[model samples]
Target: MDCLNCFEITARLHMYIDRELNSEEIAIVQEHLEDCPSCECRFHFDMRIKRLVHERCTIQHAPQHLREAVMRLAHAPAGTYAELDPELVKEIKADLKGGG
Candidate 1:
């Protein structure tokens, strides 16, 4: 197997850690990390950071008011939102058109 370059491997490292890559891609990245000291160090560093963040972070549910506001905004008619925030309504319309 041809080892990928650090840039290519690192670009996909997040996907690898997330288990989002296929088996072949994972194997290629693993092989590259085994042969490349610098990339290996970087990979380990990123992994450690992610682990720390995961350990330290706590999921917080949105406050009821915020959730209600979002629900209202999401369900509001275009003209209704225009009266509240014309610019935001325009952006929302654009985003809807762009399939966001």
Candidate 2:
């Protein structure tokens, strides 16, 4: 089946190939692909790229110390969001009070 629009379909071809779209959206994509040859080519190309990435990429394990550091950071104080500045906190409080 010929693709309906080779150009416009390239824009969202990846998302469609990934099956990320809902059922209604899938129907639209299928209809378009069925009518357009260029779009089918683009979809095939995108699938090739995804397959290559899956074949070549490898996942890595986090270091032991990294896990421990995360545990400590997660247990830190409620107000301490991260890299907190004592001087900035004082400035914010002063601003809230309408004082320097």
Candidate 3:
């Protein structure tokens, strides 16, 4: 297979990391990554992000009150979200930290 250019390699990077590429395509991308420092760094960063999200995030149903609060905040004026219950805000912040 011909060596892939940076653009082509990057365009298919997610697929490569997800193991969706055929053997020939994988070999081409692997070769490009080996030769290109910038592309390699980007690939590493993307892989790290994918791993972090997969490991830290979970599938869960949001509570009705929390869902309602979020929907209200979403539709509210940007700076007007202060009307949301402070306790809920604190809970959300704590949950985000715990997940991270």
Error of 3 at 95 (Å): 18
TM-score of each predicted structure versus truth: 0.56, 0.51, 0.57
lDDT of 3 by residue, 3-99 (tens): 7789989999999999999999998998889999999999999999999998889678776767888788788887763476888888877777887
| TM-score between candidate 3 and the true structure | 0.57
lDDT string for model 2 (24-65, tens) is 767778888888777777788889989999888966554454
- How much is the lDDT of residue 56 in candidate 3? 88
Better of 1 and 2 by lDDT: 1
Residue-level lDDT tens digits of model 1 in 1-100: 4667788888988998889999999999988888999988988998999999998896766545545557887888876742345655566567557764
Model 2 residue 6 lDDT? Answer: 54
Which whole-number lDDT from 0 to 100 does residue 34 have in model 3?
92
Task: Report per-prediction Cα RMSD to one decimal.
Answer: 10.3, 12.3, 8.6
Number of the candidate with higher TM-score, 1 or 3: 3
Better lDDT candidate (2, 3): 3
Ranking by TM-score: 3, 1, 2
Candidate 3 segments exceeding 4 Å error? 60-100
Query: Which window of ten consecutive residues has the lowest lDDT sum in model 1?
Result: 81-90
